[model samples]
Target chain A: DVKVTQSSRYLVKRTGEKVFLECVQDMDHENMFWYRQDPGLGLRLIYFSYDVKMKEKGDIPEGYSVSREKKERFSLILESASTNQTSMYLCASSLKGYEQYFGPGTRLTVT
Target chain B: DQQVKQNSPSLSVQEGRISILNCDYTNSMFDYFLWYKKYPAEGPTFLISISSIKDKNEDGRFTVFLNKSAKHLSLHIVPSQPGDSAVYFCAASDRSGGGADGLTFGKGTHLIIQP
Candidate 1:
């Protein structure tokens, strides 16, 4: 089966600490996305990479960044974890912007 | 502003009944719509999708209906099972904006199935 996997299912971080959430897809899709899923706000895209080393800011890219060193892997980085940044982080991959396959998600708790 | 809207935050239905979840969109440029089901602590999974060219699409017990004129679409689940209970998010995409696109999602409707 096609699969998207994340490095962590849950993470706890202290304020001001740098954080990295990793995702990988075996499908060799060119498009990879990072989104923060929050109550009442739904899934807001933080950043996406259509190709390796190419990234674009999404609707809510503030305080976040992403890296796509390889086509099969995309990473979301929080420069500094804050209490308000605590939320579910999702990673997804798609071929040519079509139906996306998502990872299980990493729930981050920044305290 | 939310381009895709799921006004209902929650819905409850009994087992063996039909569960209707509604969504509306404001962007006329949107040509593709999709429904995703998410359980707690898990990522949302693609459920069904409908393109602007079609009005209805069905897969097994789930169906998606699109009304382009009204800018509305809905997902129907027949004989709602407990396993079917989850958060449903409506999303849309417009390729006109350029680049490989990302989806605009609604707040999500939490569906509850009771026996």
Candidate 2:
């Protein structure tokens, strides 16, 4: 079974603070994605990487960026965290044209 | 604009009954559909999937039915148990994009099973 692990299960940060969320997948899948889930609105893609050092902006990528220094690891960075950024963040990995396996989400609280 | 929609925000059914969750997509380009179940504080888990080429796909007590003409799909869970209670999200992908593009998801429907 594919295992995707996140660095933190819960986090709290003050406004304007920079935050980094880490994710690692054991399956060595080529595709990695970051998404945020909010009430009323479902999970919205934030960023995705198809290869190491390659990233694409998803529907909601503002204030967020990503890095893929290694094939098994992907990171999400928030340049300046705001109160509105508080939400559940999910990391997922998938092979080309296959179903994605998601990691235990990180619930972030930006106060 | 929302490409995918789940009209029902929540559904309540007695345990051991059938739970039906519906989904609709506005994009005709979407050819692959999937259903995911999410428990509180946990990431959504892949449940079942159906391709445009088929109308139905079954796994265990969960089955997905797709209607290409209507651009809609439904997931049916028979003999639903308490463990079946969770948020169900319907997602679609344009396979022609070669899977690099992430899936478009609906708002999700919360299913509650009452014993």
Candidate 3:
């Protein structure tokens, strides 16, 4: 089965602090994505990577960035955590023209 | 503007009843559509998908129908069970980048199945 793992399930950070959320997929899929889920807003894409060292901005990439140094690993970085940035983060991996598999997700709170 | 829209915020259905969730998209570029189910704290999981070339696709108890002309799609769950209670999100993709562009998602509908 396809397994996607995130570094943390829950995290708390202070405002202005930098935070990193990591995700790794065992299936070796070519595409990795990061999304944030908010109440009433559903899930909004933050960033995505199609290959190692390649990245693309999604609909809501303003306060976030992503890094994919290895094919199986993708990381999402928050330059400076803000109250608005506190939300559930999800990671997904998918092959070309296939459905994506998702990680358990990380709920981050910025105080 | 919201490219995808799930007008209903929630729906309640009794066990063994058919539950239908509807979605609409305004973007003509969306050629592929998908449905995802999400629980409380877990991430959303892929449920079903339909390409623009097909009008309907089914898997077990779940079926998805797509109408290109109306830019609408719906997911139907037959004999809804307790496990079917969750948030359902409708997503669409243009496939212009071969899935690398990601997908646009709707606000989601919370489904509740009563026994």
Residue-level lDDT of model 3, residues B13-103, one tens digit each, is 9999999999999999888899999999998989999999999999999999998999899999997999999999999988874648598
Task: Give candidate 1 regions above 4 Å deviation.
Answer: none
After aligning candidate 2 to the native by TM-score, how far in Å is the CA of A26 from where it should be? 0.3
DockQ, each predicted model: 0.79, 0.73, 0.78
For every candidate, C-alpha RMSD to the true structure in Å:
0.9, 0.8, 0.9
In candidate 1, how many Å is residue A41 off?
Answer: 1.5
- Please provide, for model 1 over B4-113, each residue's C-alpha lDDT reduced to its tens digit, 9 standing for 90 to 100: 99999999999999999999999999999999999999999999999899999999999999999999999999979999989999999986666667988999999999
User: lDDT of candidate 2 vs native?
Assistant: 0.94
Chain B TM, cand. 2: 0.97
DockQ of 1: 0.79
Sort the predicted structures by DockQ, highest score first: 1, 3, 2
**lDDT per residue (tens digit) for residues A30-96 in model 1:** 9999999988899998999889999999998999989999999999999998999999999999987
Model 2 quality (TM-score): 0.98
Per-residue lDDT value at A74 in model 3: 99
Ordered by lDDT, highest first, the candidates read 2, 3, 1
Residue B34 in model 1: lDDT: 91
> What are the runs in model 3 whose C-alpha is more than 4 Å off?
none
Cα deviation at A60, candidate 1, in Å, is 0.7
Total clashing pairs in model 2: 0
Alpha carbon lDDT of residue A33, candidate 3? 95
Quick one: best lDDT, which candidate?
Answer: 2
